[model samples]
Target: MEQPFRVCIFCIRTFIHRVLEPPDDVKKLFQDYSQNGTMSMDGLLKFLSKVQGQNNAKEDDAEVIFNSLKHLNIFPRKGLNLEAFYRYLLGDLNTPLSPRVHQDMTAPLAHYFMYTGHNSYLTGNQFSSKSSVRPIKKALQNGVRVIELDLWPARNIKSVVLHGGNNDVEVRHGGTLTTSVKLLKCLRAIKEFAFQVSEYPVVITFEDHLTADLQEKVAKMVTKTFGGMLYRPEIDGLEKLSPESLKKKILISTKPPREYLETQNSNSPHKSEKTSEEQGG
Candidate 1:
């Protein structure tokens, strides 16, 4: 099932409003600190001193802290924007809503443990199950940074997502129960939900079984819908990207080259290799 775009927007807006709205006590504190619709640096220091009463503030330390707040635009040359000040003090206005882990971004991609979602389209059992875009929204909301898509060609339709080995092109579970969702619907859901929970990049792993024409359609839709948010190797380049460099972007991981796959298969250990030479002889 596909959720309306407006519904997604409304949910995001409501969440933002809830987070940014100050509580009654906070509002009263801000009002008490404000003089002429703004709080002066002195007033802010007083409020901070009261909150940190146990730790005595040194003359130079207070000046340095005040300067830092000024640098953050929390305090302007005229005075402090009380609403902005309150939000900053409460740590509610930051994009990620959590402190970022300081890591060496130049490290190889293998070092990171990506938050991944498996078989993201189905809301229930893989066989004889229902498929919906709701799963994508829920995964992203809970911070699943990598999502899977199983794509198949559909007759008289562009494409659909399903899990079945049958040659039939419709979206179904075990070639039995049909799902109403299509490829575009799932793509739309991703676009809507990807960045809501976190500002980090999202990676989509596609398992595609579509004709070249339909694949082109998929590519076009992705580009048109996601626009600058979708990562392009031509612009961003083919080098291994660091987490910092790929922030707020969407990346797609497709099947590797046949040669690479063949090499992997050849290098893989087999049961035959474990057999004793004497037994084989």
Candidate 2:
């Protein structure tokens, strides 16, 4: 119930009105705090401070929360009841994710257990899945900070995602009969939705099977699509790069040519290692 006071020029009077709504166990708690079958601002303030851990909670803060959850048509008009409390707490207002970035973003990317999505482009089973941007968008929207894409040459066309013409490289699972999603299109989707939910860095790990030329083309496409949002490590080791320093940045990772060649040579019968330019000299 609310005791709203009113004074009309010379006349003065007061009126009382009511009403409210949370869950069963929570409902018991709410009932415990309420008075005279109505939840007033004081009860809510107590709940916020003690139960919800808003230790420094003030009446104003409680008012804000109550106003948001309180039923407009309820008797008190500005009061929260059992149902209102239950519904708001169970709704999006009570999302598990923190409203703002609270963790130590200054730590190295390795220090964080990022929400990673393996083969994020596939909509179904890996062997016979359709490659599309829907999954990519959903992942980004749901706060998947790391995405994996396997890049290969496009079927029948070198390129298709970029604006100029065909995207020479496409994304799919390697050595499997799976559909492909254009690299540029994927990049575009990443660019568009990467930070929609959180202002954190997104790492894209590539299972690259493209040749040197196609790799160059992909690099261009990525640069064009992401523009300034792409993280180009100005320094050497990624160990020094912190997540705080890479906010809103897109970091792409793939095996280097030297590493790829070394692995291939290790599997060969002759195992003849080619000399690098520096060693050749």
Candidate 3:
């Protein structure tokens, strides 16, 4: 039913005419709570606490809600009629998730569900599309926490992030026509928009295809771009890392290059970086 007008537009003084038609069950419920065709404060409080599962709802909460839902200056803060009740059913008041964060923030990173962007560089196709930092910026702006970047050596000595770099010789979409975006541009984009939507940590997962030298360049680029915002674990294992502790931090997620690990193995007697690994929850 499109525009189910309950009252005349010209003669509307009591409540705003409901734009949506209510179902049979909703009408029955509205009538059930109605006393003299008006849902009173006590009725609303009962509906909220019992039917809506707002267990902590009290008299003042009911009054505040009742006052907010009534037709503003058109009606006094007395009760909710069918129109007001229908509006309440369609409004932001009825929600599954809390409007505010109510859970404990002091938990491991893995314990939480984070927004992740897959193939964060590519703008379109997997095989032959131009990769850009715009999508990364959009993802960050939308509160994405995990961003996946496939890092590869550019034609020159610079580094670039792209998709479909599965080929051995060239960093392309396996030999297809996928274009690439510069790593510096992606990092700068991340740095600019990472914390705009949220204060929690942002994880950059690099699908590394660069050589040892390019890896060093990438290290420099990441460090310079993020600066003090980068998260470095104080202890060897990140056992106690939590969302509360890592507020407004950018984190790195990638395996060290084999060339660098081999160099470490040859330089020291112990296995060093190779044998060192930690399990986190």
lDDT of 1 by residue, 122-141 (tens): 88877666888898899999
TM accuracy, model 2: 0.68
Q: Per-residue lDDT tens digits of candidate 2, residues 1-281?
A: 44656587777576756333233688788788887566778888888778877688898876766666544444365467666666556766567665667667887778878899999999999898899999999999999999998888777442344443645578888768888878878988999999999888999998887778888888888888899999887766688788888889999998855546877778876544444444677
Model 1: which residue pairs collide? none
Better of 1 and 2 by lDDT: 2
Question: Candidate 3, 41: how far from true, in Å?
Answer: 16
Sort by TM-score, best first: 2, 3, 1
* Cα TM-score of candidate 3: 0.58
Query: What ranges in model 3 sit over 4 Å off?
Result: 1-18, 21-85, 92-94, 156-175, 258-281
TM-score, per-candidate, Cα-based: 0.51, 0.68, 0.58
User: How large an RMSD does model 1 have?
Assistant: 13.4
lDDT of 2 at 5: 64
Lowest lDDT sum, 10 consecutive residues, model 1, at 164-173
